[model samples]
Target: MVSIAIIGRPNVGKSTLFNRLVGKRLALVDDQPGVTRDRRPGEGRLMDLSFEIVDTAGLENAHSESLSGRMREQTEEAIRIADLSLFMVDVKSGITPEDQDFAEVARRAGGKIVLVANKAEARDSDIGYLDAYALGLGDPVAISAEHGEGMGDLRDALVEALGIEVFDRDAVASDEAIVDVPVPEDDDTPLPYDETKPLRMAIVGRPNAGKSTLVNRMLGEERMLTGPEAGITRDSISVEWEWRGRHFKIFDTAGLRRKARVQEKLEKLSVADALRALKFAEVVVIVLDVTIPFERQDLTIVDLIAREGRAPVIAFNKWDIAEDRQELAKELREKTERLLPQVRGIRTVMISGETGEGLDRLMKAVVDTHRTWNSRVTTAKLNQWLERTIAHHPPPAVSGRRVTIKFMTQVKTRPPTFMLSTTRPEAIGASYSRYIINGLRDSFDLKGVPIRLGLRKPRNPYAAKKKRSS
Candidate 1:
């Protein structure tokens, strides 16, 4: 539903309206004019209507400045993509010559326009509303963005223009997925894997980290290329092996750089291949050199695991040449705490992928993290925790009314996502959100995996409980 664009001359609350609609501060807004430089896209939901929203830079007279030319191009592209336009005007200042020029340009696009007179809070809006009628776009809606007034008129305008019907989220409390995490039922023993079906594993790290030798050691034969130079293994090559009674498939991938410095041809293609393999994997093992483990690029890879919502276990390989294993291990924990803060409590195991030392711990950690990633909490316990949490702090009241958060549950679990239907999602502080996540980690032992808390509109104005099916 991403067909709406907020366009104006300058500083008429276009960015403010974007932030309010997006429910997140994605675009920067300032008192200064022309703060937005290009078209920015974001996800927004107006009640039940979830759609894409584009906030664009203020239009200006055709000029030769490099930045202006780029902005104009971006603005034109937004107009072409838009299904409907929200033509904004400053009610306080009325229409200027620049506004008239911009109106003509917007009309040339030949899309439906809904005039919006912003800053209509304290003062009258008849002058700006009257001027907008002359533009021949249609009837204009007056709004006060700061006070959140006249949103119903805007909603009605959108409904009439977009031909959309208003709807509400279903309030059914889902109970089916709480069925215990599935294990090998009846056949506790993992039967022998079919010859054609290979158990795959992907080993990824920074450059010159001995990824090639590790694969050679595991295979006991030089099936893949080994070199001292960085990026010798450009393609994701898979190798099959049998460990104990379990079969295995390992994918060796090219290293990822610091994102900005990734300007090479072969490296980019190689990285893209690795990302695809990661997406297809059931388990992902991120290998890092002991000397410089979890660098910014390494964190980027680890964060990619959480972003992709995969089960991850980190292996600090090449431990044979390390100065002191004890001290290095302590330093690694500190670095994980300081740097990769999002996925806290991730299992960090030390291993020599070359010499096969500590490989047992690496395998065990992967199985453990996978189980936790598929975890789900029971309704009784979840409600109990929610009760205790709300009793302790209580959702902070706004405008002299204390809001209530009645029910909650784990909606889905790849990385364990939860949803809390509340009176106002905006009032939940970041610290409190972290508190709930930390409590779940500590109480439920859900360590080292990402936990997502999604806030949704309350079902009833009185009590907005949360639940889900999938």
Candidate 2:
């Protein structure tokens, strides 16, 4: 792949430009300088030109063993491997001595460099843009990474530095190349069990519970920012990946906290984004620290997933450090059974995010749960089962009248929603509802999936006619 790296002194808008090019906030960005201390790589696209981009730590001069010096080594390494580098500078701050130092480093690295003067949205930045010429790199492309200004000039600079033919933006938009190909007609046939369709899964849990670490392990790379600090992730980022030839799209969501404890405005937004990810996901893996297995918030998160009609897999993470494996497993199983009985028989997998242990089993459980979530029960089989189930332990009487469930039909799948037509639907007790739902789970082998059971009294035609006459 064509390789490019972003290298600059501390707080020069390098991370912001990196995010702008990579199309997401994959790197952590804060007003605090030196937020990024590692080299992060991602696939990036500029219009139609695709390349691998690396976001490096802010460059600075320090003792080799020091943190800032270590960060500088990472940036130098990125420059060494890259075919081109975007040497970014903060125009508002002008060319500091550090900027000149990194510029000299970039020049000696022997890679094509594009000088990017960021924060040029303000008129006052003109002097800094001129100061960039003293570095003797090249004419600086002045732009604002935050406001997305002067991208055309930046694109032109990148094209020239990469030594590529000028890209025809209009040609990229036109469909002329595929005009001769016949369009396939749409058929009303239902799709068969196809693995080509991307499996949509979301990883979620409480803050500092190794949610991001587990995601990075599954991806086989550090795609998300992870540190000892809580709430490092603020946005829900979906990454596409393939395993064993099966395509999958996994969402790495921000850690969820109790609503009452969530006081920060940014934390509230992050929680909202995480919830949105859960709703869009077909299967959710609730990451729990084995030592602190089931906090009240973890159960709440699982309940939310169940109520949203999505399948759930309880992943006990950090298993490598847990004290007693057998005891912890028993406790976790018992807690899952007692607490999340609504999503009865949810699959639980033990994993270690650091050691990469039990990942295959976790993935297998995920795939299996997704299959169960999309399962369908035949109408005849459902009704037959319902008859036998009701016969064994009939619905209890309410005010001297027993509720009679006449029929049941599956309304949908993907969480397996069903509608039961019944006499005295309003009289159905919560206990009886749980009994029927448990029966459905047991009979259909629909483990690890949330089942939605709805009661409906058959629409009364006479009532509608009576109302019209009145």
Candidate 3:
């Protein structure tokens, strides 16, 4: 792993030592000086030295077509693809001239640098920690990174500049081997899908809806920091893809604007880091902007990804600069089935994140809405589709008595939750729970996701002997 990066210049806490070596407050730490303009990455650790850290942007010598020169070309492409850099500086602000011109641009972009010297718990940070040995890139490490103090001499200057056999960890845990698998104590079984796991997803929408230009057109690089700026992303980055062989991770967030124009505080920490990447997404694409597609803040971000149950996928993007493209894709698919009928058949597509057209039908509608949000049915096919959906229409007469529904099951699947067993779970209404969630999404093809039913009742075993004989 050994990646590193962190570098220097603006508000030198370098995202508070990159949220203290990735224990995650994942970037966007405002004391504002170019509140971090991009380059993120994570997975770090220190005591035992795990690696890959990143968190860049604040280097600025600006002017090559502004926006602080595309944030100093994303911190000089994270110090030419890191293998250790750190650099930092602000020893209570002493070593300036933009820290000797980004320490001679991280010593002409060659790697292994270190030299931290952060706020070293400021007692006038000892003449900027002895004026950081005149920007020569060596003996500094003196940190504080916001009071987590010298972090064991910045993990002994990154184990004396990347040695300790590049963090062995028992030869990488004996080159991986752990296979347990045996859990079907029958809750209607069905879990097995692991195509080598990964798929977390998350893109999201609203401001400048090309969600970081469709994540730089699905990582064909420039990784993320597009412009013509709307909210130039403010952090929720993630990124480790792979498609035709599965594995994902995605999460490019921050654009969601409405809560009264998100009255600052860095746009409310970039809309709480885009609702914590739409609640740790399991699938959520949204995107939109094909000339203002479904605005009302894009159906309130598709009803907040159907109240955070996730599995979404809508896309649209700039459809190569639209204009009656097949009658605006048939009036945006009849306004996405009349404004997203709670994700009914929701899987839109039509793209052009700056011309990579329909990104393979938006990742095949996000791997078929994450395989129907991890579907699972069989509790005897959910009681034979709840007895032909209650013989085509039952569960009605409430006070006059007919509300039965004695059982149903599937109590879980990423968005496939179920549970009925009713006699009168308060006469289950909301139009008979949308007719048993539209007959379990038309008898289990489960359409684009968000299902969850819930009810309950069947308890009266003589009501505890009629409450102890009244």
Candidate 4:
């Protein structure tokens, strides 16, 4: 695929243009200068053309060891690797000294450059558009990345610069490649498992918890840069691989510290990126150091996974170093239950990231948890179980009248959510709800996944008649 890099001075709408092409908010965008410190790469689409697009930090002159200098290095590396560079300048701001300097640098980089005069929608930008010719990068493609104006001209320019055939204008405008599948006639029948859709899983934990190491072990290669230093990973990077003929997409996320300690701007962005991965994932593996496993931060991460409704599997890393394995396992189980009662019976596995021991068992646990997370129960079976459960231990009374559960149905699954209709639904307290949830978990074998039970008041048949009379 053709790789393109968006290179420009600070706040010229380069990141905005990158987001526009990628069709998603993959990079952080803000009004402030230098919001993007790292070079982020994503798949981009322009009309019918598909390619890889990289968003780089704004170019600036700084000391080699300074933060801005590191950003400059990252930008230069991106430019060096890209087949084409989109040298952007804020036409509204006109041609500045910084723009002139970077223009020369981009010219020396020796790649096909297409000058983009962003924010050209304004009438005042006419002079700046003419001034862009002084950079000697050919005719500038006037555009407004924010408002999405002049995209057709930009597409034409890219096609010309890349030396590709003219794209069919009528082709569908989709950011990703799509494959057609036959639709099922029956709505009740679940779709078959799609091996093409990669199972997305995220490995997350506190700093120095061997997240990167575990990723390397799983891939059977040192794909991730690992070290003894803490916070080595600054962004959530995803790697695609296959395990046992099943395609998988795993994300290795930045180690999260407590909110009070995370004061740095870049660290905050990294944490936000990790959370995006967590929400995107189908299953989350919380990797913990066996020696210091049950930290408050670990519990906090587990709570986050549960609240996000993603299936979770706890992996005690570095288990090979422990002395009393059996005793430690018993203590771990007890602590997990006591600490995370919200998600009881979550699957846990002990593994060594260094030696690759117990990885098979860990994968088994992950696959099982994912299956249970997606498991659904039919309404007939659900109502039957609900009836039997309520008969065994009926809902207690609040004040003078007793609460009555009329009917129940399974709404959906993927960490199953259910709806219950009852008389005076608000009368059911949290303890009773817990009892019903526990009953559902035990009866349907829906263990090791989060379950959501919502209550609804019974419909009033006479309310409509009363409204009609009024």
Using all chains and alpha carbons, the TM-scores for the candidates as numbered come to 0.54, 0.80, 0.37, 0.73
The number of clashing residue pairs in each candidate reads 7, 0, 0, 0
Error of 3 at 35 (Å): 11
- Lowest summed lDDT window (length 10), candidate 2: 174-183
Task: Give lDDT tens digits, candidate 4, residues 251-276.
Answer: 88899999999998878988998998
User: What lDDT does the true structure give each of the candidates?
Assistant: 0.72, 0.81, 0.81, 0.84
Cα displacement (Å) at residue 223, model 3:
15
Query: Which of the numbered candidates is closest to the native, going by highest TM-score?
Result: 2
Residue range with the least summed lDDT across 10 consecutive positions in model 4: 177-186
Residue-level error in angstroms, candidate 1, position 263: 1.8
lDDT of 2 by residue, 1-470 (tens): 67889999888887788788778766666776776665666766676666677888889889976656656776788899898899999999789998998899999999899999999997789999999999999899998999889888987888888756433223122111111121122221223555666788899999988987888798887656676777766667677778778888788888898999999766776788788778878889999988887899999999999888878998999999988789878988998899887887999999999889999999889888988876777777888998899889999988898787889887667777778899888898888888888889999898778888889998777998899999
Clashes of 3: 0
Candidate closer to the true structure by lDDT (higher is better), 1 or 4: 4
Highest lDDT model number: 4
2 or 3, which is superior by TM-score?
Answer: 2
**Which lDDT value does model 3 have at 452?**
76
